[model samples]
Target: MSDAISAASLLMAVVAILYGAWYQEIMHAIKITVPKHDKQINFMVVHNVLVSRCLPLTIMAAIVFLVFLPDVIEILQHALSVLGEMGVKSYRKYDSVRTAFCLVVFVSFIIAMHLCRLTRALMEVRRKLK
Candidate 1:
C-alpha cells in the first residue's frame, strides 16, 4: 500500500510539473484567466490556480483512501479499542494517522465537489465556443 501510494505520489508530481507548464492553455480554453491581471491578485484566478495545482495531490490522496480503506478501518477499530481501555491517552498513539485520514477524506470530498463545478464550467465554455 505504501509502495502504491509512493508511486502515485511520484506520478502526480511529474504530472503536476507538466500541468503547470501547460495550464495556461487549459485556462485559455476554459476562459478562466480572462480580463488579465496587472500586479494584482484576482481572487478567482488565484482560486482556480490553487485548485488546479492541488488537484494532483487531492487525486492521489483520494486514490490512497480508496485503496487503503480496509486497512484504515481495521486500524481505526484497533485505535478505538485502545481508546476504550486507555481513555484519552490512546489518542496519542494514533492521533496523527487518524487526523490525517479524516483530513484526506474530507479534502478529497471537497475537491471532488469542486471538480464537478469545474466540469460544468468547462462544458459551458465548450458550448459557448461551439
Candidate 2:
C-alpha cells in the first residue's frame, strides 16, 4: 500500500510539472503577439530606462534581497527609520512578504520585457503606417 501511494504521488508530481511547462509555453507564445493598442504606448523614455538601467538594477536587488531577506529587512528598517518614526509599520511576516515580493519582482520583469518587445513591434508598424 505504501509503495502504491509513493508511486502515485510521484506520478502526480510528474504530471503537474508537465502541465506547468505546457501552460508556460502556451502563455509565452500568446505574449509575443502584438496587439493594436500596444502600438500606442509611448515606449520612448520608459522603455529605454527599463531596458538600460531599471531592469538590471531591479534584477540584482531582487536577488540580493531574496538571498538575504532578514538582513535586507533590518537594513530597510534602519535606513528608513523615519517611516517608523512617522508610525508606519514594518512587515512582521518577513518570510511571507518576501515570497510575495519575489513574485512581484518576477511579474514586473516579465511585463517590462513584454513592453520592450511591443515597443519594437510598434516601431516596425509605424514605418508601414506612414
Candidate 2 deviant stretches above 4 angstroms: 1-94
Q: After superposition on all CA atoms, how large is the RMSD of candidate 2? A: 15.4
Per-residue lDDT of candidate 1, residues 4-85 (tens digit): 4454445445544655564564455456443433413344444454456435444544564465556556667887899899
The residue pairs found clashing in candidate 2 are: none
Q: If scored against the real structure, what TM-score would every candidate get? A: 0.48, 0.30
- How far residue 32's Cα lies from its native spot in candidate 1, in Å, is 7.1
Instruction: List the global CA lDDT of all models.
Output: 0.53, 0.43
Candidate 2 lDDT over 53-104, as tens digits, reads 4344334433433444454355456546745665445444234443444444
**How many residue pairs clash in all the candidates, one count each?**
0, 0
Best prediction by lDDT: 1
